[model samples]
Target: MMKLWGRDTSVNVQKVLWVLDELGLPYERIDVGGPFGGLDTPEYARLNPNRKIPVLEDGNFSIWESGAIVRYLAEAYGAGKLWPADVKSRALATQWCNWCQGSVYVDFIVNTFQPLIRVTAAERDSGSLAAAAERVGKAFQILDPALAGHDFIVGDELSFADIEIGALMHRYFTLPIDRPALPDVEAWYGRLKTRPAYQKHIMQDWTTMKIPGA
Candidate 1:
């Protein structure tokens, strides 16, 4: 059995949970971090040196980093569903995943969210937050255009790429931030909203997010 450790409301954790749901994979989730707060313990650190939540433990294997863990599952178990096999196809899938982690994650979750929602207003870095919002808005423009004719991020089927990017989309729409036009992103999200597993997990008030405007 796969065991996940993180709070339900956490955006990082939500991504992992959302992926598991998409793959129809069963796993046990342990509440940690945020309100739960077990990430700093020696036992927790034994799994991840960074002491981050959303660690995935399967039998003797343990992996950290939300994106990596989701990818591992998709590659190992999901295959054609979330993990593409062909070189070009897999590259395309991974392209969106990398963009979510590198570009979107940095702009929305890291810069703006870290300051605005993850920390209190008094403790926030206003300049960085505003800059992050600008970058994210620009990045969304890139996605909005690509998603114009497509229902999902990559391939005809719903892949981990869609699952990965959709998690960030939920966070972006919820935040009190100015956003660019994203009709396609909106449509894509509408489809995701219909999933039973997404409704079961990912949607809720954040309990321990440190961002300010949240």
Candidate 2:
């Protein structure tokens, strides 16, 4: 059986788990990182030099980095669907996947989410949060138009691009902050809720991550 090392609470780890569940692949998930606190060990370091939460072990082969792992799984198991066998379609989907990590995640998740959930009220910086929110709004404005006629990121069918971007939707909608009304984005989010894999993994309760008054 395949082995996955990471905690359920981690967003990066959750991405891998969601893919696994979507593919109907059986794997043993070993709790690590955060409160589990096993990421710094020598054995874990050998698996991931960056000391990241998620590490995928398939027999003797090991892979780290959430995005790479997701890509690997999709290529290895999910063809003509989640992986997108067509070259042009795959490229388009990959573009959105990269966009989510490179652009959306940095401003929305790293800056806004980290402060609101991880940092206490006393330690929070209002200026930084406001700046992050502005960036997030701008990012969503770009996304809203891209998702105008498409139910999913790439097309009508679910793809890895949807998996990557959809993972952050729960936080985007639920977080206590002023948000511009992007009807297309909101409609896309509603469509995502219809998926079983997304419902099980991405739509999980995140109240524990939120600090008081956050």
Candidate 3:
């Protein structure tokens, strides 16, 4: 059996979990990081030098970084399901996966989520939060058109790109912020919600991460 390390509430960890479930791969998950607080240990450091959550151990092989783990699982196990068989299609999927991490994740987590959820109301900077929201919204605007005629990021079928980007949809929609009207993006999110794996892993309650009254 494979082993995974991370807390369930972590969005990065949830991305890996979603992929594992989607591929029907069996794995044991050990809680660490965040309030669980096992990341600083030497053993944990050996698993992931960055001390990040969501490390995957397959027998003697170990892989860290949520995006890499997701891609590894999809390519190794999912093939035509999550990993696109065509070279060009796979490239496109990888492109969106990187875009989600590079463009969407930073602004959403640092500028928006941390300010609104992790910080106290008195400490929250409305200006920065609003700016982040705008930037994230613009990022989604680029995505909305790409999803206009497609149900998933790459094509009609679910792909690694969806798992990478859709992992953040729950937070993006649930966060208390002004969002521009994005019909295609909203429709894509609705499609993702219909998946059992997505619902189980991505739709989890995240109130634990939020400060009281936040």
Candidate 4:
């Protein structure tokens, strides 16, 4: 059996967990991070020097980085499904996977999400938050056209790209900043909620985040 070390609430960790659920791959999870901090420990650092949550160990291979792990799992265990076998198609789908890290999640995390993490501690920055939201909204505008009529982000079929974006979308919906209305965004997100694996692993209660007004 494979072993995964990370916290359930971590967005990055959620990515891998959703992929595992999608593939129906059984694995053991060891809590590490947040309330249970072992990331900087010698053992944890050896596997992932970055000290990030979600490090996967399968047989003799140990992998770090949430997105990379999801891609690997899809390729190794779900070639035709989460990861398409076709070259061009796979390239297109993978683009959004890479986009999610720098585009969708990047701006949002820098803005609203940062302040929300230490809510009761008082570090809200209305100006910066609004600016970041504007940037994030612009990215959504790009997605709006891309998702015009598609159920998933990549193509007609579900892929790791969908799962990656879906996890980030979950955070946006739960963020303190009121969600901007984007019909296409809403519709795409609605489709994800219908997926058994997505709901089971991604639709977590926001209250647990203890993100103040959450």
Candidate 5:
């Protein structure tokens, strides 16, 4: 059996959990990081040098980084399910996955999520939050057209690309911020919401991460 280390509330960790469930793989999850506070230990450092929440141990092999783990699992287990069989399709999936990490993750988590949820309302900078919202909105605008006719990021099927990008949608829609019209993206998100794995992992309560009044 595989072992996963990370708190369930973590979005990054949630991505891994979602994939694991989607693939119908059974694994033990040990809570760590955030309030659990096991990340700084020497034992934990050996698993992940960055001291991140998620670390997957599959027998003697160990992997860190959510995106890498997702890809590894998909290729090793999911085959045609999550990992696209076609070379070009796989490339396109990877492109979107990287795009999510490079563009959406930074803007959403670092700029928007941290400011609004982690920080208290009094100390929060409205201007910076607004700017972050705009940046995130613009990022989604690019995605909107791509999803115009497609149900998922790559195609009609749920792939690694959707797991990477769609994981952030719950927060994006739930957070108190002004969002521009994104019909296609909204429709795509709606489709994702209907999935049991997505609902179980991605659409989790996050009030604990927020300030009292925020």
Candidate 6:
């Protein structure tokens, strides 16, 4: 049986959970981060040296890094679906996945989310937060046009690329901040919300993670 080590609150962990649910792969999920903190233990370090929340253990093989784990599952299990068989389509999907991790996640989740949600109003830097939010909006501006004629990134259907990027949509929309009008991205997000797997994994309430008076 496959075992996933991470708390469900993590967007990265949600990415894996969404993939597993989409692929219809059954696995046991162990809570092990944030409030459940076992990541620093020696036993846990053997699984992931970085002490990150998500670590996929498939029998004797163990893999960390959420992006790498998602790619592994897509390649190993999702052929025509998430992985995409065509060479050009596969390459495009891969590009979007990398873009999500490198560009989107960095600007939206790391820069904006961490400071806005985790830091209290008294301790937070308003200027920095504003800058980060502006950067995130610009990042989405680049993504908005890409969805002009498509329902999903890389293609008309859902793929691993969507899994990676869609995982952050809940947070992006839920954040208590102003955003520019992005009709195409909004439609794309609406489509993602219709998926059962996405609803189950990515559409989680993040009220608890928000710092008081933030």
The candidate maximizing lDDT is 5
The per-candidate count of clashes, in order, stands at 8, 0, 0, 0, 0, 0
Q: List the residue pairs that clash in candidate 6.
A: none
lDDT tens per residue, model 6, 1-214:
8999999999999999999989999999999999898988999999999999799999899999998899999999998788888889889888888877777778787778988888888998888877888887888888899889977887787888888888888889989877888899999999999999999999998887887877
The residue-by-residue lDDT of candidate 2 on 1-214, one tens digit each, is: 8999999888888888899998999999999998889878899999999998799998899999888898899989888768876788899988988988888998887899889888888889989998898888778888898888878887788888888888888888988877888899899999988878888878888888676765
Residue 48 lDDT (model 5):
93
Q: lDDT values of the candidates?
A: 0.79, 0.87, 0.92, 0.82, 0.92, 0.88
**Candidate 4 CA-lDDT value:** 0.82
- Give the TM-scores of the predictions, in the order they appear: 0.88, 0.95, 0.98, 0.92, 0.98, 0.96
Please provide, for model 1 over 49-102, each residue's C-alpha lDDT reduced to its tens digit, 9 standing for 90 to 100: 898878999899999988898889889888777887777877887898888777
Cα lDDT tens digits, model 3, 1-214, are 9999999989999999999999899999999988899999999999999998889999999999899999999999998799988999999999998898889899998889888878888878899899999999999999999998888988899999999999999999998898999999999999999999999999987776888867
Better of 4 and 5 by lDDT: 5
Ten-residue stretch with the least lDDT total in model 6: 99-108
Give me the runs in candidate 5 sitting further than 4 Å from their true place.
Answer: none
* Residue 149 displacement in candidate 4 (angstroms): 2.7
lDDT of 5 by residue, 21-97 (tens): 99999999999998899999999999998999789999999999999999999999999799989999899999999
Native-to-model Cα distance after best TM-score fit, residue 106 in candidate 1, in Å: 2.1
* Model 6: CA > 4 A from native: none
Rank candidates by lDDT, best first: 5, 3, 6, 2, 4, 1
